[model samples]
Target: MNIFDIPAQAWAGQILIGLINGSFYAILSLGLAVIFGLLNIVNFAHGAFYMMGAMATWMLGNYLGLGYWASMLLAPLLVGLVGIVLERLFISRIYHLDHTYSMLLTYGMTLMIESLFRNAYGTSGLPYSAPVALQGGTNLGVLFMPNYRLWVVGAAVAVCLATWLLIEKTRLGAYLRAATENASMARALGINVPRMLTLTYGCGVGLAALAGVFAVPVYGANPAMGSDLLIVVFAVVAIGGMGSILGSIVTGLVLGLMEGLTKVVYPEASTTVVFVAMIIVLLVKPTGLFGESR
Candidate 1:
């Protein structure tokens, strides 16, 4: 094979890898968009919560004898509960204050959580194996694809679409949007705005935790793993438009594919491609591709 002639199979594999990464980006950015859109909170600690979810999965498996499937259900719930507590005890208090305060508070929380995990587990990652059933790959004529990766992509897509439908088409989502737009009017109409806010925050964190659970098997659980990816996720959110749910999903997948293509064509630019995309998007559309202009 000529040096410049990349095989079709190789391109397929790279695209698959890009899809997997994009799935993760979509999930993480979706969570951030939901939280920020509904609550107007930046949620700097989201990555930490993601780390906690992965950690929770590992711990559940090692200590509680839970399997991957069980941890899938339990870890997100646990992280979401923690989110509820955080919202009630700390985040809720900062709602009336400047946005900077919330950012600082979440940043501090991220540090504390990361530090705690680092002190306990060190900075190294703990391996989590894929479930026995999903350990192999399927041959798709042109390319062989891992079962676990396919699952990740499918699950992420289902989640993103379901969330969008819930928010855009459902009655409960309508109430949530109403509360987000005008809490006072929502409250006057007998809606419990506070409870909605609390649940929305938990839901956002739960989505992050769900991503973490899916990630542990692929990336392994590490103290700084979330932080390492957090910046990329932020870029995804920015490129997609901060509060635009559909934008987050599409931008994440596109950027992931772009990064994958960059890796094949110009490896040196892969790491910075997403940020570069963000800058370009900002230059062209300051409000973001899907974001409404303020």
Candidate 2:
């Protein structure tokens, strides 16, 4: 099959879809980057929290009669609060331990959370529709672009920028960065180290939850939704570099486009292309594309 024979519309459609997916990747990986970069926690349960965000949205809409906008606002806030609670109760206790312990604890938490959700939701997956206001598509010459998807991309971009600005520009961000580098020094200077750590973790979890909230309208609410996508998000983080914010954001968008191109050129290879790229990156620069050498 000649590449030239493929319709432009097909290419455009896939790329648009890829961009939407990349937006989700960017948000989710940003959260992972923050957690790992600042708190040094593995946070395998990030995915579980993500699932909770989506499920909580569905429950809010279904059980409480909350509309899309309300659910969207409430879900992440609720999930973030839960994250703060969990950090205070469990995560803070392990901060002094090796990273492996954190990973094991979070992974165990993932299993338990997924199990409870799966048992309750029963795997059929709850359906979520785009808000009525965004239920249409716009003609974009090459292909029709769904308004909801466009909104998703726009919203994700806003979230990413806000987070970047918060961490890189603000005074509070300086304190957070200082604490990340030296908790004892930060404490000596009158910064609340423990509180800062807890807030950082909560913020990371909140980002993941926000991604999940955006995702439900597009992907629907499934108990395994987070776990399934979690693998790819992890790859995005690794490819971007574990703790590099810009790396996570840039690599995610690039890989999403790469995935789209692969799907267009060779459908069979699309799924494995990310892992293949991940392997090459790991072999070439174990520190990651944007990671600084420690």
Candidate 3:
């Protein structure tokens, strides 16, 4: 159990795996945070949207010979466009009502979407293999890591950083923040707040779709994938304190790594670690590790 005597390869392998899983949690929770921050909607259908992205990639690949790269780009755009339509057609209608109404509406939308997918694809899981270009592994001195997994982790980190910069350093981000905080004020100042809202929702949904595209090869395309993931993501967001996008990304990766470590010591506790951490976080800092006390 000494530090130098520990199994280095096994430890490195688990860490790599954890980092990859963390990447997914970070990107997914980031999408959730952005939507919640701007729209004030819980977006219960976020998971479904993510699932749809994976399914879209699978269908495109099978029917049109779309590669992973193409689907990675195309799926998000298509799903994002769908989100725009959903915002205009449904989300906009609930803006003036109580929060509960919107939550219920979104929940209903999730159920409908899930049911539709279940009817079409059945409950069984589908097979999805990693693209040939990234199907192998390489030794990194200490451990062998799958190329695709590395890509996923690198992509997620880059995305999270890019998004953080976009929101914190860009003019568009300024406008977005202004419009989100005070739509009427922004509208008076000549900003098209409604259009911005729709676009924001699209972006959020797009991020989810992006996560889905990346996840399909790893997790496969399935209807229940979203609901199951959604619960975990909710915990990630809650623990990270949805007020800050960067916070969400950081917390997700941290929890993901923690879960991985837990798996090494106590396999049975892996699944419970995140929730346990979440509970402890809530007890100590009700708003979360980086959440604001508004």
Error of 1 at 34 (Å): 0.4
lDDT of 1 by residue, 1-294 (tens): 343788777777778889999999999999999999889899899999899999999999999989999999999999999999999999999887888998999999999999999999999899999899999999988888889989999999899999999999999999999988899999999999999999999999999999999999999999998899899999999988989999999998898888887787778998999999899999999889999974
lDDT of 1 at 93: 90
TM-scores for candidates 1 onward, in order? 0.97, 0.98, 0.95
RMSD of each: 1.5, 1.0, 1.7
lDDT of 2 by residue, 1-294 (tens): 789999999899889888988899899999999999998888899899899999999999999999889888889889999999989999999988999999999999899989998998889779999899999999999988989999998999889989989999999999999998998899999999999999999999988888988999988988898889899999999998999998999888888888888888899998988899999999999989998876
Error of 3 at 266 (Å): 1.2
**TM-score of candidate 1 versus the correct structure, residues matched by position:** 0.97
Which candidate number has the best lDDT? 1
Q: What digit string (tens of lDDT, one per residue) describes model 3 on residues 233-258?
A: 98999999865698789998998898
- What are the lDDT scores of the predictions, listed in order? 0.92, 0.91, 0.88
Q: After superposing candidate 1, which stretches have Cα over 4 Å from the reference?
A: 1-4
Model 3 Cα shift for residue 18 (angstroms): 0.9
Using lDDT as the yardstick, the better of models 1 and 2 is 1
Prediction 3 global C-alpha lDDT? 0.88
Q: Which parts of model 2 have CA positions greater than 4 angstroms off? A: none
